[model samples]
Target: MRAKRCVYVVTAVLPLFLLGPARPAPAADEPFPAGRDRFSSPAADERFPAGRDRSWPLPGRPAVLRPWAPPPTPHARGHRGVDLAAPPHSPVLAVASGRVSFAGRVAGRGVVSVDLSGTGVPPLRTTYEPVRASVREGDEVTAGRPLGTLEPTVSHCPTTCLHWGLRRGRTYLDPLTLLPPWLLHPGSPVLLPVLGVPLPPPA
Candidate 1:
């Protein structure tokens, strides 16, 4: 009888001893935040739009000629920006309201960068290349303002297109994040199932 009681007590307390105290249940109204392993979620999509009512550099939601494919290293081979399918001489518009940081030629191709302030450290700068400038450096431009005309002088694509790039400091980010109707948002989480137990049914 003593042996049986000791074994029972050990079985009951061993799990608690190993696992420690239980965590409090999350609040009913509180949002379950996305974890650091958000990329592991099966339902999580790859791309997400950045802002609401953001205009495209080219009209009519132009298809991407070349998508953003960041390289392993800065100097390695990669397409840092998306090449939007646009006709030659097509008007390139500003995607957001910001001051024109640069509007000039680089390596024989015209380039324009808008200094969008208050975004992050180094500020967010939107870039368009192979465009003949209509805006100049230090110009205050509104969203959808005409920045330049798309030129094929430096076209990377076999066909004419606009190379749209977004940079915060030295890092390049997907420019499409500026488009509205976000595909992903923080603070929304889907519960993952436990390894050995059945998942709870939807409420």
Candidate 2:
């Protein structure tokens, strides 16, 4: 009787031990090691200096300025921007992420200017004309996003291109240096070479 009771208890307890709670394996998409938080960084603010990337606004070769061309007339002052010779109606992309600060005409120049307002640095200003603007003031924009179409009627140049300008306050810096290395050919003698003119040393 005693041996039979012990055998029965062992059989009953063995099944209960074997039938422990089932734990499902974690799914493949679940992050390992349990809890983690993403998206912790502060939201991007373009106007601040820490937020902006000061690289060239567009990709590809920048339009070359003519060496012998007379400087802007006294009435017009100095050239405030560099002309990029592109075909008419070429898509114009934003240099960095920012808000559209200004978009309108400038007298006879038929100029249109877009001011980008974020990314910790000073606001970026791009000016062009005779082209339709796709963005309005306060609209947030990202780098390389299409801002508008380039129109050739404003400059009257043989080619339709963009006029890109970079500014830090009132001072103007050479826009070429701000471009990425791939856009420039290393070991090339100069950044921009004018026919018959001596080139300045690379900056």
Candidate 3:
């Protein structure tokens, strides 16, 4: 009888040990890693308009003159910008509100770079070149403000086009995806004031 009672006690204790403690359910307000905010605001489309006559620089006419040409090869492997299908000397504009960080040539790329900060959005980095820049470093710019005229030089591309590219920190992003919706259309023409003097290249 004592053996039977000991076996029953062991069986009850064994089940309790096996059960263990109950885990607390996850809280409703708990944040998940996958849902972390990556951008301050929603990402803009790639073909966002900068100003009048200027559209998102992408494959297709007016903006990106050569739809299929690859980016110019400066070195063997440094990919920096996109080729817009615009006519030579076509007006190019700033895509976001920021200060001009750089506005000159870097390794023959007609380099015009803008640092988009304090625009109620994340900082934007863009580069365009082989064109004449209107604004300089420290110049404050609004979205769609004219930065320069796309220079008519066949030196960079076989056909005339603006090489437009964007970055955030060190990550390269497709300019067309961040462009405004209206500029995405092939027929929309964005017109705005030409703010600075045109700095044409040497004759």
Candidate 4:
């Protein structure tokens, strides 16, 4: 698929304001350990630091309608990523700084893939699907930069939604692991003194 290379220089920057409110993620097409809740943090997610480099892929951090459920084998039936509830044409932003590796279609659905900078070896690549891309392949994009808008078409969910995926080479992982707690599990918006607000006790 040799398409023309196009560059997109983003002039307008978006503030990290999303952490709005998304419905709690629900386990889809699989069963979890009997005692655990669907949203329970897995051990793999504990290693990630709450770094500033990451941001929500969508405004308001849309509801994760379908959580990642990996298959025992690659060819088995399972969701490779997550399905986030979104409206048609909502902007889909980058989760981190990266170069757009591929911005095209797959199985009749628009898709975008980004190879993240600084991640070791085969760099972590984030993917967004059912999106009509505004940025083209090889373009460098910053976190929160618009990659495209969710296409107004049939979605895997009952309503329109965006499929968000992340991978390191051939391995699949939870996309939510990239988000910091504040953005992944934000409380109601609040205002406090920036100078010297009292800190909450250490967890």
Query: 8-124 in candidate 4: lDDT tens per residue?
Result: 111111122443455554554643333322232235433344578777889976887788876554344467788889899999999999899999999999999999887776887
- Candidate 3, 1-203: lDDT as tens digits: 66666665565556543553353332222122232222211243233334443334322334443222112231222334456667777778776677888888776656678876543344667777776888888898766788888888877567886777776664455665555445555353434333443433333
lDDT (CA) per prediction: 0.68, 0.49, 0.57, 0.75
Worst 10 residues of 4 by lDDT: 4-13
Q: In TM-score terms, which candidate is top?
A: 4
Stretches > 4 Å off in candidate 2: 1-62, 65-77, 108-124, 154-156, 186-203
Arrange candidates by lDDT, highest first: which order? 4, 1, 3, 2
In candidate 3, position 120 carries an lDDT of: 33
Clashing pairs in 4: none
Please report how far candidate 4 places residue 156 from its true position, in Å.
Answer: 1.4
Please provide, for model 1 over 115-192, each residue's C-alpha lDDT reduced to its tens digit, 9 standing for 90 to 100: 774565577788998899999899998778899999965447778889888766655676766665332132444443
Q: Which candidate is the best by lDDT?
A: 4
Candidate 2 per-residue lDDT over residues 87-142, each given as its tens digit: 66777777666667766566644344556554234554555555567777677777
Worst 10 residues of 1 by lDDT: 36-45
Task: Output the TM-score of candidate 2.
Answer: 0.50
lDDT-wise, the better of 2 and 4 is 4
Model 3 regions lying over 4 Å from their true place:
1-80, 118-122, 186-203
Global lDDT of model 2: 0.49
